[model samples]
Target: MAAAPSGPVGPNPPVIAVVGPTGSGKSDLAVHLALELDGEVINADAMQFYRGMDIGTAKISVAERRGVPHHLLDTMDVTEEASVSAFQADCRAAIRDIHSRGKRAILAGGSGLYVRAALDVLEFPGTDPAVRERLEREHAQAGLRPLQERLRSVDPVSADRLGDARRVIRALEVFELTGRPFSSFMPSREYFQPAVQIGLDVDRDVLRDRLAGRVHRMVDAGLLAEVARLDAAGLRRGKTASRALGYAQFLKVLDGESDTASAAEETIVATRQFARRQLTWFRADPRIHWLDWQDPDLVAKAAGICASPASVI
Candidate 1:
């Protein structure tokens, strides 16, 4: 076996982020790297922010963490929406705290925007409630197609990229607020802080099968019950949490609109699609050093990357 790299030295090592699609073993690899590098893990997975969203999200258990300190898990209630702007502040604070203690900070998740917000030179545009409210009203009155068409007219790039109604509406709102294309605000490849992103590369065929099986396992592990518990806690009131992959589908089961088997299958399909989107988003970034997900020396290789001065961006 290869020897572990001595790990990054000096008081302010670059932030390390493990990023890839769901079911790519990012959390386990992050924990291993944290143990090897004497670092702490900070979550970038938006869903993992909720307090009771464990089973469906596959959040690492306290024991599974292997005693490495983790930050930003379960920091919000189910009824609250997860905010990328808020997360940017919180994530930066965590990174500062970890670096102050002379330890590396490892950010692990597949949330592309959240990952970029933490590591890249990104700035969020402020929202205007009046504009947002007006756009939302237009959406409700005229439906999504009209708003999507309007966004395409003003910001074609964002129009082409955004799929959901909420994002499309948000794009329109941004255009009205700033007279600038929402895409103009996208973070450039430049790092906001010294950082390195390690991406996990998995074969699409293998990843598809793995995601299907993982969704089934989550259901068998009582994901439905977990969703029920959160729903009772007003999860449906949450704009973001209500739409999460497994939680959304399982809520239909709770509503008598679907069965457990059907919900599990839907969750599997949705997860696979989500993983594809994640791959697409991460692949566009040229800086991520991708390692084979199946590599036996994955942690050692990642630690080696951390220790190498050249890996710092």
Candidate 2:
């Protein structure tokens, strides 16, 4: 691997990863830092990578980005089942290009796993078709509960956060095939790159209130309209793209199975649950350096951390 780029240890050639839960204001923070630090934003969010997923994914807009260089947002279609490898390649290229131009690369998003993949030198164990087939059979017979139970037995930490059936099946596949816990293969460095991390923090109550408000705003911002357009575009039902939080839930409304009110409520609930999972993921990571989302000196604190011995030495 190439050596970490040389620089003054703060706000420059090195990478700065800004990661936090949804509604934590990470995207805006990255944009601001980029403007101040000669940086470009590298998206690490899984959902935001897809096109026509703007509002539901809480994607940053061109206007909101304020002429700052942002990479990877809205870079894929919803029909594409993107992977960590694909994101890794794109991120490496973006970062390399930014460095060649003598600017910082700020990776900012809510997807902890993607962030880790980019920052850490992780070796994901190879997939085993037999293991995956067996898991699928078990899931088909007993539904997802048993598979989820098996995952908890093997890698409780990952299982606890990844509670959904699909995630559980994938985790079990990795464990069975690798003969090791999923977490064991993660990068030695928690942040991927040795660059500093600036985590966004907000009061629990404040964040909840903000989330609620954002949900309403999303509705007013044509979230339903966007979902309709996606449907019109022929994204299949149950496909990953069709299953995006707001869009999927609303599709049921459009299908006459539920009312708009109920779908909106379900979307809110799912979004909040996803945020909780995001918090769990970020908390488990030790590389993050906290930045109070409301603090008047957040940027200063981050700048200090970036220049500190822990970051530079």
Q: Candidate 2's residue-wise lDDT over 35-146, tens digit each?
A: 6666778888888888888887888888999998889887877777767877887887888888778787889988887887787777766776687788888888989888
Q: Which residue pairs collide, candidate 1?
A: none
> Quick one: RMSD of model 2?
4.6
Per-model TM-score versus the true fold = 0.96, 0.84
Give the winner by TM-score.
1
lDDT of candidate 2?
Answer: 0.77
Clashing pairs in 2: 119-192, 119-193, 120-192
Q: What does candidate 1's lDDT look like per residue over 1-313, in tens digits?
A: 4445645566667899999999999999999988888889999999999999999999999999999999999999989978899999999999999998888899999999999999988988888889888888988898899988898999999989998888998888888888999999999999987888899999999999998888888988999999999999999999999999999999999999999999999999899999999999999999999999999988888889987889888
Stretches of candidate 2 above 4 Å error? 1-12, 128-138, 145-162, 175-183, 190-192, 237-239, 307-313
After best superposition, candidate 1 residue 82: deviation in angstroms? 1.3
